[model samples]
Target: MSTTIPGPVLQEADWHRLLLLRATRPDVVARAYAERRRPGRLLSERGTMFLLAADHPARGALTVGGDALAMSDRRSLLARIVAALEHPDVDGVLGTPDVVEELLLLGALDGKVVIGSMNRGGLDGATWTMDDRFTAYDAAQLAACRLDGGKMLLRMDDRDPATATTIESCAQAVSELAQQGLMAMVEPLPYQRREDGSLVLCKNTRDLARAVTVASGLGTTSAYTWLKLPACDEPEVVFGATTLPCVVLGGVPGPDPEQDLRSWGRSLTHPAVRGLVVGRALLYPADGDVKASVDAAARVLRAVQPSARV
Candidate 1:
């Protein structure tokens, strides 16, 4: 990681400041981590959260639609993220350590609800992708960093023996995070192994509902667990399976951004859905205007969610 002052937000003097601080003051990151401010309440009276997701690159899954390396450029990605954060409705961001630390240094994370992504070793298109390894923040690490929560990718495939191990790991993480009084945002997506041995997420209403119940029941205590689910058709069927608060996730970008937003809007009508955590679709949109795309999504959020007393 070159210590260039991460985004377009920095002036020339800031670059020098960054390099010098990195070379002479290695303790700065720890200090920054220790000193980053939090929003105090995870879900304010607005009653819904709109988080930008930036943890994809760590999984070696950077392609946004047709572009193979849409997120490979750190400068561009950080700039887009900073732009998205400028929106008033945007509650926070979820990312791996590298991205989070960079934003922290750039002062882009103050008073935000930061969620640390917990697993990344299960690279995209890998033969063993289902067993997803926990390579990023653990429960203790999240607690020390004072992050609001930890997110785990749970792709449950009945055919894969590795699913058991991943489930056990996620269960422990959920329990540990709960003990620390932190949110455990678990993405419990149902997966199916094809005849060719490739695993694919089963997006049907039934499978998704099953995954939700399974995820909601993880750990000794479900008090601190939240489900990150797909914004599927029949949101009631999928979301009705659990009483746990759910956040709909944006998957790969579709050709039509407006269509995607409409689908997400429908899901928000379901009472169980609290908000959305969108990534490529919101960050790297088809129109290539990150801020406009973010604002559009924000509008969808504001339009659908009922007004609550703050």
Candidate 2:
């Protein structure tokens, strides 16, 4: 008599066979299941992705909403982030775990491109300015949460040995993320300790070139790596650095938002620039209109490329 396996066991065997098939036929499997299995929800079909930077608090940028420590007001920041997320033009957001956790808790992260800020120990007011420690979300945490990727601030002060450690740690982080198939955005700045003992972040042409080289060469895999750069005073100098994709950082809000947008627009058109990662300029605008600011930034991103900007 022909013996038959139990129905459940037979089904399990079939499932294993299918998994093996998929493993061998990666292209077909990816087309069929990768999208569905993707961790975070992807941005809509809009060409450009606008990442709202709200990680100032982690760097001691607590002043907002007219309160010096307004960023500490999680409620207000959460509301603002939710409102930004609701905007049709806003693509994604950039923030530390504190803010990302808030977004996740509020259920606002669904279908959104969530980027975790990896390092924030180099507080703006810290005495040990060059000693930037990876005190935020890490690759393992990001993978555990099924998060999309991570971003780290790597400010190198040649004068300070602490920067060497930061460089090594960042390199390991990049390799770890790559091994896990996660993306990592590295913002490298050549910095120096000033005469007054304060850290002076550099944006000069030579400095930017060094920063780009260091960032691009980090980690074992550069496929998923990206550069977060400043809108250099001299666009030509900054844009000439590396072929790696770049995202212009929206620094502290200035007196002229329009000019700021114009500069950002110029950078967006640069060959190396991939997109924009702005914070105070768009989030804490002088007019306090997040939607309008986001819309304006989106326009710049859209104008640069006909394809989906993100």
Candidate 3:
């Protein structure tokens, strides 16, 4: 089962309208949020959420596979997203304020689950990448916009003192968002610096599991918390660390798409996993077909476990 997603085809004139609105009627963003149609429930009847992730560019990590500037083009990115949203199986989207507002103004997000990306100050390849500051939507802003939830990234590196501050901020965000009856998504990954000082995600299963456990216990309460985790080898080794609902995130794409799809399949079947929140591997596939990659992932979610996670 695959979907044929059309190539990006947003008109320059259509996009100019968005640009014009941003300059002249900037206040209309408030009205768009007020008038947008929201979903009746967060989860589908099958008990799953298949959301597209468009929050990467805000973090200065715009590379997609070998293309370092792939996401730098906003028009192409928006067009791909709009096409993907045309698929009924796509639940909603998780993005920063600018991307979300563009969709709202373009009428691309209706009856969708919109989750605002909370922290993105940790630019790619930055020396202080471990700090992960809250530079985007705050809890109050999410509530004001009527967004369904807020998502934050937590990268823990024992060597970096900045990690401690990030943990505190994420904990605060979780407590505040939960208090408003909104969902709080936390992506906790273990990090380590190479001999050359380049930061790399620690793929060790035990370290990954430890990261998950640590994030699971964050904030004053975990009532409305969900985790965005990577689907790695021995899914149990990482996912078994927490009972919180988890969504497998699609990071960079591998040379073989089949291998990536299989990895996702393994994680989607886990008892702890709720659904998928994929990005690049789907949006900017090596083949440039966003629909096929997203559809393949959606099928995995359907074929795996469709039982309740919330």
**Candidate No. with top TM-score:** 3
Candidate 2 per-residue C-alpha lDDT over 1-310 given as tens digits, one digit per residue, 9 for 90 to 100 = 1111111111344445544654675354323322323324333464345677877788886764345765665555665667677776666777886577545544566666777888888888687656778888899887776678889998888888888888998999999899888888899888877798877778787888878888999998898788888888666667667776678988766678889888888777776776788876776555556667778887777788644243
Higher-ranked by TM-score: 2 or 3 = 3
Q: After superposition, how far is residue 262 of candidate 3 from its true place, in Å?
A: 0.4
- Write candidate 3's Cα lDDT for 152-202 as tens digits: 999999999999999999999999998888999999999888899998888
What TM-score should be assigned to candidate 2? 0.81
The reply for model 2, stretches above 4 Å from the true place, is 1-47, 64-67, 305-310
| Per-candidate local distance difference test | 0.86, 0.72, 0.88
lDDT of 1 by residue, 94-211 (tens): 9999899888887889989999999887788898888899999999999998899999999998988888988999999999999999999999989888888777778999999999
Candidate 2 clashing pairs?
47-308, 47-309, 48-309, 48-310, 49-310
| Candidate 2 steric clashes | 5
